[model samples]
Target chain A: MRLSIENLYHTYGKGLAFETAALKDVSFTIEEGEFVSFIGSTGCGKSTLAQHLNGLLKPDSGRVLVDGKDINEKTPEAMALRHRIGLVFQYPEYQLFEETVLKDVMFGPKNLGCSEEDALRRSRGALSLVSIDPDIFGQRSPFELSGGQKRRVAIAGVLAMEPELLILDEPTAGLDPQGHDEILDMVLALRKNPKLSIVMISHNMADVVELSDKILLLSHGELLKLGTPQEVFGDAELMARSGILPPPAASFVRRLAEKNSFFSSLSPALTTEAAAEEIAKALQGKFE
Target chain B: MENIIEVKNITFSYPESEEDAPAEPTLKDLSLDIRNGEFVAIVGPNGSGKSTLAKCLNALLLPEEGKVCVAGMDTSDEDLIWKIRSQVGMVFQNPDNQLVSSVVEDDVAFGPENLGVDPAEIRRRVDEALKAVNMYDNRRKGPHQLSGGQKQRVAIAGVLAMQSSCMIFDEPTAMLDPSGRAEIIDVICDLHRQGKTIVLITHFMEEAAKADRIVVLKDGQLAMEGTPLEVFAREDRLREMKLVLPFAIELADQLKARGIELPKDIVTEEDLMAALESLTAGRKTAGEAVPCA
Candidate 1:
């Protein structure tokens, strides 16, 4: 489904003595099946923007359009639209409350009034999608699992709802490298669904380079930059101003340019593989 | 090098594991000495007992069969545990888990007060600690209002207020973002520069690259221990342990495998460029910035 947010403004403690404008005139769009990423410094309305996409929070001014439908709290269809968009929060394990993993995963589908047999089936399918063994872990309590495992289960619980637009807020935070590997793999594998759209927020530039198709930069609640990760990292001065560190590949290329005036300009590099390839070819030209 | 902390044939088992698990021990005859002012990092996969080793350093977890000495003080002595902890303050993974007071300054003061420091002395330490972590401006702010990175800075400040000679961080940046991790690392490096011994435990290989020495823990044993270059050069061993090498090292290794003339010592982006520029010197003309290792 297409999601368009236009001139959105949200303030906490409105009319109170301590009002804070978290988001101001924020405008962005995510087409169906597109992978969009929102990046900004801390408390710059990244999370606030994501919350408006699904009905978790309403905008004080402006509108959130889900397939041209306004998703305001006043709308009769707002509750149903909540099911269409699934959000796996920053730390989702905090929301889990069930005796068994199956029960936890079934929470979404069951809430949507699916029958027991169908809820069980959806829960099992979601469990398998996250690579968790259903038979082995279905009956087990979530508290007994490791922090990473619990997070996956929490994500699967959201997946059980079959959301068309999947929003993940720092899905790999606080995980070990291996756990990070597993989490990203799960996120990438979900692309096989074909109909699903993914919107993820990440502070790690490396991960963002790997995942995002469109990178939206939010600086102090403003739409600073919206383009490919390559475009964003290419501007060294702006990146430095925003306090966003370039991915190591970009940094390496920039460093090389500084020393060798012959190599005055280079395309943006993301992964280590790309950097090595581009640098090697550039060096060959330099020597030959 | 003079040893500040010595580990001698240590062995330990957590109390609540499976009874029939054969008592495999968390630390198996592990022995090492941390030089007085060295910056060391311990890295291993989950459940590898790197944290267990950290706890043992400050007497939080005593070794069942061996001894851990911090500046010549034995860990097993009950009366000396508090003194040892003061000498080697620790910062844990979760900042929220350790901070006790509501305000930033109050939280920092908690550590000095615990040692029964003089009121005026505690006030001095509190200011010094906040300044050390760069959290002096937010001293009056409530702990809950600060961001995750700021909270971690407060935690570092808390540990600093105790006047510890050495600091140990048990994956202190695990819960923080890239910026937060950078901030905490900067604090650790500053402390190291100021002549305080630092031992940091982390899963991020890139972070480990910044350390002077690296100790790899596996199943509660010392699998590998050496400088960053020495340990990272052994890609096969690190991979087998489910540990990833730094991106720079991986890129260098990839080029080396492809028959390019990159050196084994190329562990950083700067080093990689240096090696490349030397080979491509003829094409590089005036004003072309050439890299140097």
Candidate 2:
């Protein structure tokens, strides 16, 4: 399904003594199967913009459209649109509550009113998708598992809903490097499904640059830049102004460009692999 | 030259819960000596006893098999536990959990007041600590109203008000963003420069690289311990322990594998940049190069 947000505006503590605008005139669109990333400094309205996608928070102005229909409409059909979009919050493992892992994973589908047999099937499928062996973990208590395992189980709970569009807010926060890679791998694997669209809010610039097809940069409740990873990371000054630097590879390339004029052609190397390749290429034809 | 904190063959295990399983030890035969005014970083994967070790340093968890001494005071001595704690103040992962008072200045003063310091002395310490963390301007603001970095600074101020000679940060930046992490790191480095010993436990390899020494743990045992240059050069051992190398080290290793002649000791970003600049200096173009789109 196509998800489009236009001219969105939101405020916190409206009419209060300490009123603050969290989002202002933010607009973006995510087509089916596209991977979009929202990045900025902390408290920069990235979460506020993501909340608008599934009607968790209604914008004070503008609209959120799912397949050209406003999701904010006060109708049963609009309310059901929430099931179409799944949001996995930061530290989602904290939301896990059940005696057994299988029971916890089944909660989403069961809450959606699916039959027991269907819920069981969906829960097993979701568990396996996240590489959790249902036979070994299904009977175990989620609280007994390791940090990474608990996180995968929590993500599986969300996946059981069969959300066509999955939104994860800092899914890998506080996880070790291995857990971080595992979560990213799960998201990438899920993107292989033709019906799935992924939107992630991330603070890790390297992960965002490596994974995102389109990146939306937000600053102080406003859209700063929305473009491909290359385009956004290429603008060093703008990213610096947002209190964030590009990934190490990109920053290295920019530094190299300043020192050696021959390196300016490859200004924004977004990944380590790309930086290595560019460095090799630049040195191969000369200086031998 | 003097050891501020010393752990001698400490072995620790958690008590069993309702879950049907054996209670395994979290720290096993771990021994470390942190020198006065030294900056040491403890790095390990999850469940490697990093946090357990931090608790042992300040007498929060006494070693079952061995002893921990802080500034010559034994932690296992019940009467000296408070003295050991005051000599080595700790800042934990969560800022919100540590901030006890609504106002920033009051929260900072709480530590000193609990220590039974004179009222005038408490005011002086609170002022100095807030200024040291660069949160003096926001001293009157409520703790919840500040940014994550600001709140963390206030938390550091609380610890600083105790007049501790050494600080132990237990993944203090784990819950913070990159900018927030930078702020905390900056504060820690400043404290280090001001002659306070620092023990930083972090999963971020880049942050660990700033330390004077690094101690790597695996399965509650000391897997590797050396300077950042020495420890990071053992890439195979670090990878086996499930710890990722810093970005510069990884990139340099990749480039080296692809026939680049970078030195083996390249761990920090500055080192990598310098190596690359020297390698590509001869190939500098004569005219201004075109900028990327």
Candidate 3:
């Protein structure tokens, strides 16, 4: 699905003394089936923009469009569109409430009015989608599991819904190194399927580098820059100006290039894989 | 030679879960000695007992089998709970949950007041604590009104008001943004530099690299312990422990795998860049540099 936000503004407590504009004139689009990352400093309206897509938040001004159709159309199709967009909150595990993991995973599809059999089937598939063992763990209580396990079960709940677009708001927070990588790999795999559109709100630049096809930079609730990861990370000056730190790898590669023209010439190889390839070639040349 | 905090074969388990594994300690017989004014980072994958270790340090949970001594006071001594906590201030993972008072200054004062300090003394300590965390300007602000980072700083300030000679942070940056995490790390280091023994429990390799000592825990046992370079130098061991290194270290390791001449102890972006520059610099200064590939 292609998600488009036009002239969007989100204000809390309108017409009151506590009135604060959380988002001001923020607009961007996620092309169909593209992995788009939303990066910004804290309180930069990344979450606000994501909430706008599913009607969880209504814009104070302007509109949100999914597949060129305005989401605020007040039609049954608009309501259906909301279901097609799955919004996973941060610490989704905290939201899990069912007695068993299977029931919890099946909750979303069941809410969508799927048959008992169908919901259970999707739940099984979803458990596997998140790399959980459906037979063993699905029968146990979510509370009985570890923190990382609870998180995967919660994500499975959303996956069971089988939405076209998955909006993950800091899904990797509080996870240890192994747990963080597992979630990131799940995300990276989903992006490769060529049908899932992703809108990830992340503080980890490494995630953005590996997963995002386009980067939408937000600053003070306004759109700062929208481009490919390379293009966005290539501009060290712009990243610094926008109060966003570049991914460690991009920032490192750039600093390397600054001290040596060879690295700078390679320019926008921001990922670790890319950096290694460039240096390997440079070394092979040195030997020859 | 002077250790501010010492753990002698300590073991701990939640009171409720004590019987779940009676034979084995939920936290194994771990031993450590933290010198005054040192910033030490304790890291492991989830359920590796880092948080349990932090709680044990402050006597929130007593050891089932051994002992935890904070500033020479044994955690097993019930009467010393307050004194132990005051001496070793703790900052939890979630600041929102830990903060009891609504306003900043009041929260800071709460710590001092709980220790039976005088009203005037509490006021002075509160102000001093807030200033230490750079939250003095927001003294009157509501905790809800502050950002996550600021709220955490306020929490730290509250901890500081107790005038603790030691501080323990349990995954403090786990819930914060990069800048927020950076700010918290700076404050933690600042406190350490002021002669307070600091123990940081986290999963972030980058943050752990900044510490003077890095201890990796696995399966409730100490898997590895050393300086950041010493711990990270064993790439295979770290990867085997299910721990992640800083991106720079991983990037440098990848280059090393491909037979590139780069330092293995690269912990930060700038460090790796500087190392790479020197790798090329010596050549450029040579009689004739190698041509580009």
Candidate 4:
């Protein structure tokens, strides 16, 4: 799906004494199959924007268009369109309330009017896509699984809906390094299907740099920048102003540049491998 | 320094729902000591008993087989449970769940109020705790008004108000943004500097690197324990246990593999940068002497 937000504005406790604009004049587009990321400091409206994308929150004065049709319109078609964009909230595992993992995953599809047979098929496919073996885990209670496994099952519930655009809000939060990588690998694997588009909200700059094709930077309810990872991270001043640090590799390279003129000419590498290669190349003569 | 908290031969297991089967032990025969004023980080992959161990420390979950003592009070003793809790405060992963009161100062005052401290003493402790976390200015604000980091700081202040000498944090920064994570870590470091014994359970290796010592857990067992430099040097073992090295250590490993000469003891970002700077200084002198074309 081609999802676009045009001049989105959202206010919390509107008209109350504590009224605050959560999102302000925000605009962006997620082309088909594009891996988009939203990043900012806490309370910067990243979550508010994600909720608007899936029609969970109506924009105060803007439009959320899925395939050029307003998702918020009060029509049967718009409601159906909203289902095509699935939002897996942060700590989604808490939403699991079924007797078994398989049933929990099938809940979404069943809610959308899928037949039992169809829902079962979709649920199994989703489970396997997340690398959870349905034959083994399908019979077990969702609560019995490990933390990472429970999170994957919760994501599988959204995937069972077969959303063309999947929105994950900090999917890897509270997970260990291995579990974090597992989720990222699952995202990469999902992108292999040309029809699936993914939007991830994350605090890990390294993961964002490695995974996102485009990044939307929000600060104090304003869309500060929308560009590719390189374009976004290359501007040190922009990053500093946003109160977000560059990826570790990029930050280390920038620090090196500040101390030595020779290193100043080198482009900041976003990944550790690239940064190590750059540093090694620079110090080649000394080692030899 | 005296050991503020001690875990001795502890093997803990949850009750099995099935009558015929027994639940697996979540923590197995683990023994550890936390010295007074020491900051220790515990890291492991998911389901490795990190949180289980944290719960054991403060008597949130008592060990089935062994004993836990906090400042000479046994956790198993019914009379000392409240005293032990007061001596070792715990901050959890979710900031929203830990908070009780609507206003920040009131929330911080909740712990001391529950202990039935004098009202004047409660007021003084609340003010001091809020100031320590740098949230004194937001004392009157509702808990909902604060950001995630601010909320976490409030949670920390709530613990601080209890006047706990040792703080056990279980993934406190997990739900925060990068800046929020930094803010919480800074508060934690500041608390540690003030001579509080700290037990930090985290998945973030970079945060763990700042601790005085590192404890690695795997399959409910202590896999490794040492200073950051000593523990991080065993890259293969850490990877085997499904833990990643801190960014600097990982980068240094990659650089060393590519024949870059860096000291093996490097763990933190500062150490790596210093080593690289000195190497660059060496290269500069060599460049002048050789006059490379």
Candidate 5:
């Protein structure tokens, strides 16, 4: 799905003593099959914007368009359009309340009015896509699974909806290093569908750099910058201003460039392997 | 310094359900000591028993076999449970769940209040604890009004008000954003400077690198234990345990693979930068051609 947000404005506790703008005049477009990431410090309205994409929140003013059609319209077609965008919330495992893992995943498809058999098939497919063995874990209670498994099961619930565009809010938050990698791998595998677009909201800059095709930076309810990972993370000053750090390799190269002229010629690298390769080449030239 | 906590061959397992015949022990014969005023970080993959070991530290979950002692008080002794608990405070992963009262100061005061400390003493402790975490200004604000970092600080303050000599934080920054994570880590470091024994259980290798000592667990057993320099140097073993190295160490490893010689002790970003700067500095002094700006 091609999603676009135009001049989105939202406020909480309007006209009250503590009235605050949660999102303000934010605008961005997400192309089909593109992996987009929304990143900013906490309370920068990343989550607020994610909700808007799926019509979970009504914008006080502005439009959310899915495939050139406004999703906020009061029509059956608009409602179905909104369902095509699935949002997996932070700590989504807390929402799992089913006796069996398969049943839990089937809940979303079933709720969307799919037949029982159809929902079961979708649930099995989703679980397998997440690398969970549906045959092995299908009958087990979700609560009995490990923390990482429970989180994946929760994600599978969203996948069972068969969303054209999926928005995950901090999908790897609270997971161990291995679990974190697993989730990222699952996301990559899901993209194999070719028709599924993803919008990830994450604090891990490294993961953002590794996965995102395009990045949307939000700062205090405003769309600060929208560009490729290199474009967004390349600017050290902007990252500092937004209260976020660049990916490790980028930050290291930037710091090195600041301290020495020799390192200044090296571009900011997003991954450690790339940074190491560049540094090694530079050192080889100097020594040889 | 003397040991504040000692776990000797402790084993723990959750009760089995009807479907699962028997549950494996979460922690198996795990033995370790936390020195008084020492900062220790426990790291492992999920189900590696980091949280279970933390619970065992505070007597929240007693070991099924062996013993856990806090400052010479045995955790298995029913009467000493409260005494041990009061001495070792725990801060959990989720900030919202740990908070009890709507107001920040009220929440901080809850611990001492439960201990039946007089109101005057509770007031003094609350003020000191809130100030310590740098949340003095937000004391009057409702917890819901604070950010994730602020809420975690308030949670730390709640433990501080109880005058616990040792604090066990179980992935306290797991749910926080980058800035919030930094805030909590800063508070933890500050507390450590104040001579409070710290037991930090975290998955963030960078956070663990700050601790004086690091312990690695795997399959419910102690896999490795040493200073950060010692444990981080063994990249192969750490990878086997499913733990990622800190960014600097990971980079250093990659550099080493590319035939770059860096000091083995490099763990933090600062260490890596200094090592690279020195290497480049030597080349500059050798009269290498300067690259264009």
Candidate 6:
């Protein structure tokens, strides 16, 4: 699904004493099958923006267009928009409340009025996509699964909805290093589905640098910058001012450039290999 | 200088259910000793029994076998449980789950109050603890009014109010954002500097790297234990246990692969920067042409 967000404005506790504008004039677009990452400090309305994707929160002003159709409209088409977008919350595994993994995953599809057989088929497909062996995990309660497995089961529940757009809010927040990679690999694998687009809200800048096709940077309810990883993370001063750190490689290069005039010709790099090339040049005094 | 918590051959298991065969025991014959005023980090993959080990520290769970001694008091002794608990405060992953009172100071005061400390002493401790965590200004605010970082700090403040000599944090930053995670880590580090023994159970490798010592667990057993550099040096073992090397370490390895002569001791970001700085300084003097990638 192609999502076009325009001039989004939202406020919490509107007309109350403690009213705060959580999002202000935020605008961005996410094309079909693109992996878009939203990053900012905590309480920067990343969660608020994710809710708007599925029409969970209607913007106080502005529009969220899903495939050129405004999702906030009061119509049957708008109502179905909820099913078109699946949202996986932070620590989503806590929401699992089913007797078995299969039952838990089937909940969403079943809630959408799919037949039991169809829901079971979809649940099985989703389980396999997340690399969970249905034979081993399908019969067990989600509570019995380990932390990483429980999270995957929770994600499978959403994937069973067959969303054209999947919005995840810090899906790897509490996971261990191994669990973090597992979830990330699963998300990366999901990108192979041409029909699915992903919108992720994350705080891990390294993950953003590695995975995002495009990045939307938010700072205090304002859209500070929107660009690819290289463009967003390339500007050391901007990233620093916004309270975001680029990948270590970028910072290393930036510091080296500052320390020696010879290294000034080297461009900023986001990945380890790219930075290594630059570092090797400085070591050999091969400044272009 | 002295051992504050001593776990001796502890083993624990949860009850089985009918859905499948009995699950493996959560913790195996695990033994560890946390020294006073030391910052110790326990890191492992999920189901590695890190959380189970944290629970045993303050008698939250009595080990099915063996013993846990806190500040010379045995955890299994029913009469001494309170004393052990009072000396070893605990902070959990979710700040919201641990907080009870609406007001910040009131919530912090709850711990001291429960211990039946006099109101005057409780008030003083509450103020002191809040000050320590830099939440004194928000003491009058409702718990809901604070940000996630602030709330977690308030949780730390609550623990401080109990006047515990040691603190056990169980994945305290798991639910927080990056900044919130840093806030709690800073608070704990500050507390450790103040001579309070800290046992931090975390999954983040960077956090673990900051600790004076890191303990690695694998499938409920103590797989490795040493300083951060010592434990993390075993890349093969860590990978086998499903742990990721810290980013700096990974970068250093990548650089070393490309024939960069960095010190093997480089682990933290600062270390990587210093090593690179010194290497490039040598290049400036020698004026040698390096190969470009």
Provide the TM-score for each candidate, comma-separated: 0.94, 0.96, 0.93, 0.95, 0.96, 0.94
Q: How many residue pairs clash in each candidate?
A: 7, 0, 1, 0, 0, 1
Sort candidate 2 into its docking category: acceptable
**Model 3 chain B worst lDDT run, 10 consecutive residues:** B282-291
Residue by residue across B121-193, what tens digits does model 3's lDDT show? 9888888888999999999989989889999999998888888888899989889999999999999888877
lDDT by residue (tens digit), candidate 5, B121-170: 99999999999999999899999899998999999999999999999999
How much lDDT does candidate 5 score? 0.91
Per-residue CA lDDT of model 2 for A1-288, tens digit only, reads 899999999999999998999999988889999999999998999898888899899899999999988899999899887679999888999999999999999999999999999999999999999999999999999999988889999999999999989999998888988888888898888878888999999989988987898999999999999899988988878887887778888888888778666666663688999898887767664534
Model 4 / residue B28 / CA error / Å: 1.7
Model 6 Cα shift for residue B242 (angstroms): 1.1
lDDT of 1: 0.86
Clashing pairs in 5: none
**Across residues B219-280, which tens digit of lDDT does each residue of candidate 4 receive?**
89999999998898898999888888899988998899898989888988899888887777
Clash pairs, model 1 backbone: A259-B289, A259-B290, A260-B288, A260-B289, A261-B288, A261-B289, A262-B288
> Worst ten-residue run, lDDT, model 2 chain B?
B284-293
Local error of candidate 5 at residue A243 (angstroms): 1.4
Q: Could you report the DockQ of all the candidates, in the order they appear?
A: 0.40, 0.46, 0.53, 0.50, 0.54, 0.46
lDDT by residue (A136-207, candidate 3, tens digit) is 898888987877788989988998999888999998988888888889878876777677898899998888
User: If chain B of candidate 5 is superposed on the true chain B, what is its TM-score?
Assistant: 0.95
lDDT of 5 at A103: 95
Tell me the spans in candidate 6 whose CA falls farther than 4 Å from its real position. A255-266, A286-288, B19-23, B282-293
Over 4 Å off in model 5, which ranges? B282-293
Model 4 gets an lDDT of 0.91
Model 2 per-residue lDDT at B42: 97
TM-score for chain B of all predictions:
0.92, 0.95, 0.91, 0.95, 0.95, 0.95
Alpha carbon deviation, residue A120, candidate 2 (Å): 0.9
TM-score of chain A of each: 0.95, 0.96, 0.92, 0.97, 0.97, 0.96
Which CAPRI tier for candidate 1? Answer: acceptable
